[model samples]
Target: MTLIYALEIIGTFVFAISGLRLAAKKHMDLFGATVIAFVTAVGGGTTRDVLLGAYPVAWVQDTVYPVVILLAVPFTFIFRKYIVNLKRTFFIFDTIGIALFTISGMQKALSLGIHPGLAIVMGMVSAVVGGVIRDILCNEIPLIFRKEIYATACLAGAFAFFLLDYYTTLSENIIYLITTAIIIIIRVVSIKYDLSMPKMKG
Candidate 1:
C-alpha cells in the first residue's frame, strides 16, 4: 500500500481507539462503543468527502476502514487496563490521528483541483470534525470549540504541506512526514505549555 493509504488506515485505528477509550469511560456497551469508534474514525473524512462531492465517502468505498475500526474495538477492550494506565492516551492517539488525517485530506483536495485556501480548510475539517462528533456524542465540549490549539495545529500542517509541495522538490512521502510531524509537535507543545487561543471578551 502507498504511504498515504497506510497512514490513513493507521489514523482510523488510532481514532477508533481514542473513541473507544472515551466510550468505555462513559460506561457504554460494546455496540455503543463500536458506534462511537466508527464515527470517530471516519466522521471527518465523511464530512470532507460530502463537501467535496466525492460520492460514497471514504469508509463507504473501502471496507478496510470499517474493518480497522472493528479491530480497534476489541483491541481497546483487551488493552483497557493498560490504556487506562497510560497518561494522556486519548490525547496521544487523537493527536496522531488528526495529524495524519490532515495530510491525507489536503492531498486529496489538492489532487481534486481544490484551491489551496479551501484545501487547508478541508484538511482542518478532516482532522478535527471526527473529534468534534466524538466529544458531542460523549456529552463533552468539543476540543476545537474550546480555546485549545486543536484545529489550528491542523491548519498549520495543511499550510506547511501546501508550501512544501509548491516550492520544494522534496518527495511526497517526505512532505507527508514533515507535515504530520509539524501538527503533532504543535499539538504536544500547546498542551504541555497550557497554551490556547485568546478567549472572546464580553
Candidate 2:
C-alpha cells in the first residue's frame, strides 16, 4: 500500500507540474500557476471520491499531497522551457496515471459493493477529471472533449478491467497492467490517426 500511495502521489505531482508549466507558458503568476497545478493533480481523484462517497476526500487526509504539489511548482519554474514542450510527454504519463487510477477506482468501488455500471463511471471519472481541471484553469476547453479519445481510452480500459474482474483468473497485478496497456494503446493509436468524435451540427 505504501508503494501504491507513492505512485498515486507521484502521478498527482506530475500532473500538477504539467499544469503549472502550462500556466507559466501563458505568463500566469506564481499563485495562479500553483492553483492550476494543485487542481489538476487531484481533481480527478476528488471527483471520484465524491461520487464513490469516499469522503471527506483523499487529499484532505494526506499531508504529503499538498507538500508534493508545492514541490512541483519549483520544478515547473526551473524547467519551464523543457516542460513547455511536454504536451506529448505529459499525454503519455497522464494516460498511464489515469489507467492505473481507473483500475484502482473500479477495484475500490466494487470491493465496497458498488454496482458494476456505477463502478465503470467511477473509473472514467478517476481517469480524466485531472485534465478537465487543468484545462479549465488554463482557460481552455477540456482536453477530454477536444481529444475525445483520451476519456474514451480510459473508458475502454475500464471496461476491460471489468471484464477481467468478472473472470478473476488473472492475477491482480496482471489485470491492472493489461488495463493500463489497453488505455495506452488506444490513446496512442487515436492520436496517431487524428481520431475524434464526430462533431454535431445542432
Q: Give the per-residue lDDT digits (tens) of candidate 2, residues 1-202.
A: 6434655776787778777767877889888888888888888889988877887798899888889999988876687666667678766767777777777777767877999988889878876788787887678878777745777888888899889978779987778778878988988898899888777889
- The CA lDDT at 41 in model 1 is 89
Instruction: Give every collision pair in model 2.
Output: none
Model 2 regions lying over 4 Å from their true place: none
How close is each model in CA RMSD to the real structure?
Answer: 1.1, 2.0
The best candidate by lDDT is 1
Candidate 2, residue 84: the lDDT equals 66
- Score candidate 1 by lDDT: 0.92
Error of 2 at 179 (Å): 0.6
Cα distance off (Å), candidate 1, residue 181: 0.3
